[model samples]
Target: MQLSEQCVLITGGARGLGHHLSLAFAREGAQVIINYHRSAQAAQALAAQLGPRQAIALQADVTDPAQVQAMLATAAGHFGRPLTTVVNNALAAFSFNGDARPKADAIGWDAFQSQFEGSVRGALNTVQAALPAMRAQRFGRVINIGTNLFQNPVVPYHDYTAAKAALLSLTRTLAGDLGPDGITVNMLSGGLLRSTDASAATPEAVFDYIAANTPLRSVTTPAEFADAALFFASPWARAVTGQNLVVDGGLVRD
Candidate 1:
């Protein structure tokens, strides 16, 4: 098992893409810690199925540094020491609704700041809370979830795209800063994933168009996206850091 005896913490793991990532890590023999803010029932059910020893779900608002610290402490207690991987998969409340597509003039500072708090602040809190343990073990993997839209800018989800761009910057800087400690930071950006709760509001015609235009002539599923994330967390990617791996069926060429 590539991740045997390793401990991984995934935020927003109660459902959608995060749920699949948690399962993928657990299947690779990792002791998974899932953090949820409002989906307690779903998180507990997932943990129960994975077995108490292999999976544990805790509640925490990643935007709150105090809550994030407490969640990390609880995870350490449940899974022993030396947190090996941290996946900052949490998203802001603004991302849930489909109405977030506001023109540049319509979008205000509050909207941008809210998204930043959820994407950037959440990752910072998780990294800060887990860095000490990683440094002690001299190994760590920090994978931030990002979007390919920022590169293509087809839909222009201004606030959301801007936030992910900032996260990419953080990923590179953190990789440089933490490299000496054997910690790697990277970003995984995927085109609109199919069959996720977040994409429920997206029009069927739009999805079909993307599928038709993509090189693979198919849509990317949450499970497929999880595979890319697993690579970043695995030993094979030891030399990979501060990079963005876009898994979008080669939709947008940089």
Candidate 2:
């Protein structure tokens, strides 16, 4: 679907990477549904910036199915149309501080479970809630945010990385199953971003290291990665699905 015809719901669209994604989609003429878990002020401000016609901020904890369902219904009501795109970008509370991360031996299943709930279960809730509308229209786009750690594992963020890996699997399987319904599912994975709430705890030296090692000689910005998400929701990617496009400036050349 063309961006102008799409209504997109971006979970956790108030801050960090989701903030940029919200802006990108709005700029492309899509009606944006900025779903925030706690950043209500930020979400509302962003919606105002995008204008009432182009965007609206809604509160929902993506991990909760009832909230997500209600949020989707409200989004459709506001736009007078069902959401044609869904971006699963809500992340659990996490800080990408390698030094502070719990070691694999010390980490409990709870850590993994939390990330799973955020990354996998959250996507599950939104996709399931939005499926009927998409199927009815015979068109949909599902974009799952992922990480490059699966291939490089540079920092070995066991809990976070493991959960994203499972999400990747879901992305591919969904692509296969949903393609027949005119829906496309894909993943956009990035390495340690230059700056985000989650990446703020990362050491400057580490950022420098990543930048120097990347083929682009720079750390990827949230805006850069967010722009790529537009492709998965656009007509250019109509025939593309079950794919993982790494947006870390060629850091992991798989």
Candidate 3:
């Protein structure tokens, strides 16, 4: 689908990278549905700033199919068009402070389960809820957000990385199943993004070290990574699916 033809529903679109993505897509003429679980004010403000015609804020717990369906219906009502693209960019409630994370021995299965509920299960709900409309249109784009930690576990965010790795698996499998329907599924993996709320707790030296090691000699920014996400939904990438694009400036080769 082309940018102008899309009604993009971005999960967790209230802040951080998702917020930037909402602005990026709207700037390119896509009618955006900004979905937020709790940041109602931020989401509404963003939609208002983008103007009522181009965007609207929706509330939903992406992990719940019922809420997702309601949210989708409300979004479609606002736009009078089925959503053509979906971005699963919601992170499990987590901070980037590695020192504060549970040690490997202390981490339990529940830790992994919690992350999966927010990341993997949340994506599953949104994708399934959006599938009917997408299949009916014979055109859809499902972009899942991932982290480069899977490739180079720099700080070893085990639970987060494991859940994302699972998401990547689903992305590939679903791509094959939905390929005939023209719905492309792909993952965009970014490194520690520069100064998002999640990354705000990260130590400065950590950022400096990653910057020195990366090919770009600087950590990636949210907007820069979000633009790569836009490409996945564009006609330019119609031939692409089930692939993970690392937006970490050559920090890790896939």
Instruction: Tell me, by lDDT, which candidate is best.
Output: 2
Worst 10 residues of 3 by lDDT: 148-157
Report the Cα lDDT for residue 231, model 3: 94
Candidates 1 and 3, the one with greater TM-score: 3
- Residues 81-167 of candidate 2 have per-residue lDDT tens digits of 988999999999999999998887899999999999999999999999999999999999999999999999978699999999999
Clashing pairs in 3: none
Candidate 2: the clashing residue pairs are none
The whole-model lDDT of each prediction reads 0.89, 0.94, 0.93
CA RMSD of each candidate after superposition = 1.5, 0.6, 0.8
Q: Cα lDDT of model 2 overall?
A: 0.94
- Over 1-254, each residue of candidate 1 has an lDDT whose tens digit, in order, gives 16876899999998989999999999988999989999999999999999989999999999898998899899888877658899999888644334557787787889889889999999999999998899988899999999998878878588888999999999999999999999999999998889787887788887898899999999899999988898988889999999999988899779
- The Cα error of candidate 2 at residue 189, in Å, is 0.3
User: Which sequence of candidate numbers ranks them by lDDT, best first?
Assistant: 2, 3, 1
Give the Å shift of residue 252 in candidate 1.
1.9
Off by over 4 Å in 1: 95-100
**TM-score, cand. 1:** 0.96
TM-score of each: 0.96, 0.99, 0.98
